[model samples]
Target: MASTVADVAKMIDHSLLRPELTNEDVRAGCDLAARYAVASVCVKPCDVALAATRLDGTGVSTGTVIGFPHGSSSARIKAAEARTAVSDGARELDMVLNIGRLRGGDDEAVLDDIRAVVEAAPGTVVKVIFENAYLSDAEKIRACRLSEQAGVAYVKTSTGFAPGGATLADIRLMRANVSERVKVKAAGGVRTLDVLLEMSAAGAARFGATATAAILDDLSGRLARTGVATVRGDLSTDRRMGPDR
Candidate 1:
């Protein structure tokens, strides 16, 4: 089925995780996310409370990262971070997997690391970031399997601090390997509506985008040209225009 503007908007996790971002930047990002009705505003750990406050009644969930750009933190520390973030009104948590441990073939340690956070956050949605830029294909698949076994909500592609970002091949591989219960999130490099749609077709159910405004603006323009209503299943223009038109 063709995805409408709302469909695309709901897939975005508006990223507010840049280290240099100030409180003002986070607030502006939250406003933008609310204005566009994005799925969530992914901010830094410290900004979760403020984001939640600003996003109250906005229907946009708040999210933050754990073990952030580097996944070298001990499992205990990551678990603590998750617990704190969840208590502060963060409904979603994006945590980086331990790349070094995984590379060292310590799958049990890696699984334990992920499980610790999941245990801490109980019902909170958790997206485990693979930071695929540093992992081999085999390692990536192993990470996905471990994440599924750990019962995480999603397996994400990149942290956007890596040398490379989410790629089509990686998305396809992750999608094919994981079970249906596990979703795929493509972060980094999802800067435009075209790329977002392409990733969606490749099996990315969610995207972490710093360019949420620009991409949604482009989608709005396209929908306007096609005269398609933003509401799902309206189908008023389904016959008048093709899905991509």
Candidate 2:
């Protein structure tokens, strides 16, 4: 299928979760997401309020992580974090699952941990990050089942702080295991328009990316060359470039 610039833009959740980013960086990221009209801006917990305020009325959502990088936080703490994040205007929450507990075969503990956050925010979208880098194929499948059972909105691949990120194979596996109600989000190392298309073909509905600008720019150029009309109801105006740029 031929994807327009808007289709590619909506797939991206512009990631601003790097540890060293300052408030200024967060604001800049929010601006970029708004300019391109990407799906949302995923920021650090402390930056959620800032991002929400900046992105208000821009049609882009504000999202943050809970028990990020490592999913070792207690269930109570994670639940509290979820409540606080929602209160701070976050519409989406991407939380890491307790890898240790999952690996140790404590399925109930893992399921409860996910449910704690889901229960915290009733209507908000909750994505359970599996951190697939450290998990075996069996473990990954089990995590997908647990996420589905917990009633999360999406099953995410990684935190971007891990050794590896989303792979086409992992996404396909996750999609195959989860029910239609549970969507798949591919994060970490999804840097190009080609990769985004590949993931989408593999049944991924969303993506986490730090290279939103480059990907969108590339998509725009491609669309201009093909003279394809932009997708329905997208805000971006078409830019028809000559052969020489």
Candidate 3:
């Protein structure tokens, strides 16, 4: 058993990256993040300023995505986006790596693409999204190596727009591949408290979730009932998570 509700709350980055979300929707998401005191609200690039202004002094960091669902943008373009986002007050930047390039084994291109954004934003927390659904295990390992080499803060599972999302197997693999300094962030399909716990046990330290309210609400209820909400999965074992035990 591990973690209080606050611990779980701090692990989540409330997602507001959907294309259909309006400015008002982003504002509401910011409010929700502030109320929950989550780690950050990852909004669309255009919403960075709005989210920053709304979340000011609330201790919830403002974040945005780059090259987004598709990692098709040029390295220079992605770097420009990163700089603009930082100027708009975004403290965190999540960038998608070039999936096609990675698949084609263009290691240098992939590494340079990630490095461009990291260089553009000097002090921000940059998370590299692998969009693992399309990668083989070997590819995943390579991606992790590249991310660590590029000096990223976190290596994420998916963009949530991909065909598949975070899985326990991928989380474990990513954690095993990266060094202690490089954290793993699970995103996409993390809709329940049990799922998050499973991922955490598998070695994910950060989570990107749109189902923030329900997951936290469920934990709050459990804590209220039992006076504690603890994760049962053991980090030491990193065992295969099955049916939540």
lDDT (tens digit, per residue) of candidate 2 on 2-29? 4567777888899999889999999999
Off by over 4 Å in 1: 230-245
CA-lDDT, candidates in order: 0.91, 0.90, 0.91
Q: Which model is ahead, 1 or 2, in terms of TM-score? A: 1
Better of 2 and 3 by TM-score: 3
lDDT (Cα) of model 3: 0.91
List model 3 lDDT by residue over 141-239, tens digit each: 999999999999999999999899999999999999999999999999999888887788889999999999988887777666665455343522122
Off by over 4 Å in 3: 229-245
lDDT per residue, candidate 1, 1-245, as tens digits?
66677778899999998889999999999999999999999999999999999999999999999999989999999999999999899999999999999999999999999999999999999999999999999999999999999999999999999999999999999999999999999998988776777788788999999999988887777678768656234222233333442
Score residue 116 of candidate 3 by CA lDDT.
99
96 Cα displacement, candidate 3 (Å): 0.2
Ranking under TM-score, best-scoring first? 3, 1, 2
